[model samples]
Target: MLSALKRVLIGRPLKSTELGEQKLNKTKALAILSSDALSSVAYGPEQILLVLMTVGMAAFWYSIPIGIGVLLLLTALILSYRQIIYAYPQGGGAYVVSKENLGKYPGLIAGASLLVDYILTVAVSVSAGTDAITSAFPSLHAYTVPIAVVFVILLTLLNLRGVTESASVLAYPVYLFVLALFVLIGKGLYDMATGAIPQELHTPVGTPVAGIGLFLLLKAFASGSSALTGVEAISNAIPNFRKPAPVNASRTLAAMGILLAVLFSGIVLMAYEYGIAPIAEATVVSQIAEDAFGRNFMYYAIQGTTALILILAANTGYSAFPMLAVNLAKDKFIPRMFTARGDRLGYSNGIIMLGICSILLIVLFGGHTEQLIPLYAVGVFIPFTLSQSGMMRKWLREKPAGWGIKLAINTVGAAISFVVTMMFFLTKFPQVWPVLVFLPVLIWVLLGINRHYGAVGEQLGLSTGEPVEVIEGNVLILPVAGITHVVEQSLSYARSLAASQIIAVYVPFEREEEAAFRDKWSKLHPDVRLVTLHSPYRSIIQPLMKFIDVVDRKAKENHYQVTVIIPQFIPKKGWHNFLHNQTSFYIRTRLLYQKDVIVTTVPYHLKK
Candidate 1:
């Protein structure tokens, strides 16, 4: 039934050979990979307005400068990641690139930062999406957290179904959002050019702008840089692309950069041109929309698309985290489970983990995008710095064609990203220190996992082909309930080992049952001796354990090893196992720590 549900929900499990069939083309890849970058445009402007509003109306004018600064960083990221795609064509994100060039600690730092960033991407995106809804209908404000969580679950489920399915489900909505925004931008531009401003524009008269300082401008710039969050996702997941993965990934990256620059700049300009103040529950985007088209159907359409693309943006993390986890697992930094693909040939475990983490953040932060914004850029910029530095190191060492220009570009990018990293580090220290705290802990964890795998490999004698064995006096003890065909089979199999001794012991609940079992057992097994154990407490495992302990004590004197064989009856159906006492499992679990005493089970399948 579970398998059927999985098949129904995520489609049939694909074979390893069918992997290539699941690769995504450019258009779908852009939608799946670029959602986070594009969706941030929805809340990126608002975050800036949020911080700048605290400084008063005068600081509002700084939005353009801060926005232009972020766009410059965006341009650098686009160029840097394009180089990354070509250099590490097999989808080497910051983790792989930095680890390969910048040493292990730097690589691990990059990996941990990206991991946290992806989690926040889902949280912030879903929260911003919910804000769009709450903006539309104020009555739904209280349900914002729950709504964000539900969106995470839905996005998680969609991603688990594989890339193609999710792209198909989400691509149209992204296109619709892009089209609507461009329409709004064009209409807004036409209004500006023709000098036809709306007369009934309703601007909420906010409290007068407060005192201003350089710190406030930095705060606003840090807040606005969220538009750069999803920029690296495309570079991180090149393996998910179609043939010519690097070429196609680079094209998509370029397209994403152009689209984000146009939309983000346009939205911020529109907000500033119309003098859309940071109002109550409504967002700056919503305010701009209403002023541009009023509270009509077109306004609702843009709001609807905005909500969808924002929620779907969580898919960016869903795709990247799993692949990154798989990479970490391969390096023995995390558990091996993430290395396995799901039914739909996607990294199901990683996707689910990302979703849960994102949901918890939403609940903890009360689904507020502004609250998560400060912590957002810290996770993002660390990786951006490391990735660009990794590329710089690569170019200097490789000296390929155009390496000089590439190195120069990556150098500037690395410098800018490092500055941004310190900006958030100083500005949002209280909130972002946890990320720094997690970095060394993540490195320690990776080291521990690598140590564990090494120890297991050594213990297994994997270095050599053969294991040295010394024969000892071995005794086989069959733990049976009563004389039956299953017991006979276990006894017969135990005899094949040619041990020093073979003993069959029966633990009975009552005296008569013990006597009857002995009488029946003596007639059938004349060659083997039958020992009956009587328990006063009527506990099955305790008496059996005592018997094994005695046997082990006796064997110790004789320089022998004791092996306990339990006969198991296999139920025809999975549910039928619940009907039995389950003593077979109990005995094995109890004997796991018995040194020199081996416990084994021989199963007899039941027909009905």
Candidate 2:
């Protein structure tokens, strides 16, 4: 039933032979890997405007300057991450680069920050997408959380289908969004060139507040940095590309950066030229589209695509976060189960976990993109800084061919990223306190996981290659319901296991019941002794556990082991199980926890 359900939800499972998933070519790779960066053009400009709006309309033009700064930073980041792809082909991106070139905690800091940022990315993206939906159709405003959660679920199922499958499914919506933005930019450009001058958008103007200062511009720059969050994804997932993985990954990273540059700068420029502002009811992108295309089918089409790509942009987190988690697990920083592949050859645990987290964030913030907006960039920029710094270190230490040029680029990138990271932290401080608190706790968790795995390895003696010592003698204890075929078989099997002693225990609630049990037990009292335990309160497991405890203590004193053999009858039909009280399970569960006690369940299938 479970297998059938899984097949129904995610399609049939592929064979192990088929698990070597088809390698992603550049185009599909961009669509699959670049959705987050590409889709951010939808909201990245608005995030900038949201900051600048604090200073009023006069300060809005600063978006052009802030955006130019962001693009230059993006260029440095792209250059540094491209080097990261080649240097670390095993695909740790920032975490590996930093862990290897920088110190231990630095790498951990990168990992934890990226982990948090990816979750924030999902929350921000889904909420923004839902905003787009409400923009197009305002009636669904009440169902924001539910709608966002449903989208998370839908994306999860699609991702579980497989990467190539999810990528294919997501590609069209992304393409549509990019095309819409280009058309918006092209038409806006034509208007400027032809002297048709697009007018400022005033309809549905939300909250007429405005202010401007250095602080506000700093905030805008930090917020707009979400566009750069997914830039490292392709670098981290280099192995997911076809042969010549590094080269393919490098080209894909370049392509993603170029697309992000065009779409992001184009949209921001258009908004600035068109005088679009942050509105309560509609987004800056939506407002720009309305001004450029008017309220027509094309306007609605662009809005639809925006909503889609926004929601699916969470795919960036889904695609990369799990792989990061698996790497952490490999380093013994997390549970090893994360390192296992899903039936679809994706990081199944990672994908599902990302979905669950995104759903939680969606519900927690009530699908308000703005409420969670302040915390978004804090997670991304720290890793950016750490990675570039690590790259600089990698070059200085190795001094490979062209290392001189690479080192200079990395130093510049690192310096810029470091400043952006600090700005993000200060700008989003109290709003981001939870994330700041979460990072240290996450590192502590990684350490704790490492300790536990190490302790388990030691206890299991996996490090020493020594054989486990076995107890010298064997004593068997069987709890019986009088003497039946089940008990008879259990005792016979117990005797066959080289049992030095075998005792059959019968618990009775009353003296009369004990006498009757003894009378019936006398018929099979040929070999083992029958010990009767009386329970005044009618607690079966409690009394049976005490007897096992006494036996285990005695066995330890004698340098031996006590085996508790539980004989149970399996019902022919499943419902028959409900008719039984499951006393054997209770006694076995209690006894298994006692030291020096061995537990064995012998099943007898009922014929009728």
Candidate 3:
């Protein structure tokens, strides 16, 4: 029944041989991979204006400049990531580049930062989408967190279906969003050029919060940097593209950067010309749309597309995080479960983990996009700097054809990204300090995981010239509560082993219970001897463990192997298992760690 439900939700299982068919073409790839960058226009301009608003209307003058600065950074990222795509077409992105060129610690840092940023990408994108919905229909404001969480779950299930499937589902909305924004920008610019709409002249009306200075401009620049959060995703997931993966991915990335620059700068410029201010209920884009189209169908069309692309933006994280995790897992820096693909050929574990973590952030932050922006930028720029620096090192070390130009591009990207990262730290220290603390702790945890994998490999590995020996004699012990069909089945399997001796060990809470069990054993005329252990505290596992210890010592001394056979009853219904004592479960669990002792379970299925 569960399998049927799963099939219905995520579609039928996809064969492994169909993996190549799941690869995306450029148009679908653009929608699936670039949505996060494209959708940032919804809130990126607003975040910039949010900071500049502190200084009153006059401070709004800096919005266009800040937007330009963010665009320059976007250009650098696009060029740098194109280099990354061609260089590491196998696609681990910053983590792979940093590890190969810089070192292990830097790679892990890049990995951890990207992981955090991807999670925040889902949370912030979904939250921003929900914000658009609530802005359009004020009544839904109270359910923002719930709505955002629902979108996360929906996207999770969609991606779990497979890459091509999700691209097919999301491609239309992404293109529609781009068209709507282009129309908005084109019409707004036309109006401004022809004086069709009256321009509101602004003078400083309220007291400036602080004197406009380098610090204020830097803060605004740092805040606006959220627009560049998902720029690296294309490089991270190059393998998701079709033939000539790097070229297709690079083209998609360039297209995304162009669209983002046009939309983000258009919105910022339009906000300034139309006297749009940050409102608690309405979004900056929504207000710009209203000013352009006056709450008509076009206004709602912009809001609708904005909401959709924003929600679908989370798909970028879904695509990137799992692939990055696969690399990390292959390196033994994380659990191996992430390396496994599900029936649909998606990284199910990684997708589910991303969903769960994003939902947590959404709930904790109450789905507020502004609150998550600081965390978003801090995580993003760290990897951005690391990736570019790693590329710079690569160019310097290899010195391939045209290495100097590539080196200069990556160096400029690295320097600018490093400065932006520092600015985020300095200006938003109160909000971003947690990310600073988290990055180091995450690095420590990743190192610990690597050490544990190393230790496990060393301990479990065989040495050269080691001989494999087998014991001829077998000593079997069964822990039985009472004689029943379950016990009989266990005894039958034990007898088939042809052991040297078979002992039935029983632990009884009361003296009368032991006496009754002894009588039952005699009535059965059992071939095996019965050993009774008293447990005054009624602890089943403790008394049984002591007896097993004694048996183990004697067996080893006599060169015999000890095998503990446990009789476990299988209930007809899963929930019915809760009604039983589960004594056999405890025995098997405790004996699993015992050296040179074998444990097995004989199951008796229940009809009712």
Which candidate achieves the best TM-score against the true structure? 3
Give TM-scores for every candidate, taking all chains together and pairing residue i with residue i: 0.89, 0.93, 0.97
Summarize candidate 3's per-residue lDDT along 74-167 as a digit string, tens digits: 9999999999999999999999999999999999999999999999999999999999999999999999988999999999999999999999
What is the Å distance of residue 524 in model 1 from its true position?
Answer: 5.7
Worst 10 residues of 2 by lDDT: 200-209
Clashing residue pairs found in predicted model 1: 56-209, 56-210
Find the candidate with the highest lDDT and give its number.
3
Measured on C-alpha atoms, candidate 3 has an lDDT of 0.91
Native-to-model Cα distance after best TM-score fit, residue 78 in candidate 3, in Å? 0.6
Q: Counting only residues 3 or more apart in sequence or on different chains, how many pairs clash (N, Cα, C under 3 Å) in candidate 1?
A: 2
**Against the hidden true structure, what lDDT does model 2 obtain?**
0.84
**Which regions in candidate 1 have their CA more than 4 angstroms from the true location?**
198-210, 364-366, 462-467, 472-474, 481-500, 505-527, 530-562, 569-582, 593-597, 603-608
Off by over 4 Å in 3: 202-210, 464-470
Model 1, range 1-608, lDDT digits (tens) per residue? 88888778778888888889889999999998998999888888877888877755555667787889889989998999998898888775999999999998899888888888889989988888898989999999999988998899989888888888899889999999999999999988988788776533323333244576677777777778878898999888999998899999999999999999999999987876687787768988888899899999999999999998888888898889988898888988889999988888998999999999998889899997877877887898888999999999998898999899999999989998888788788877887788768777877888899899878777888566666545478888898887678888999999899989998888888899998888888788888877888976888888888888999998878778899998999988999998888989988988998776888899999999
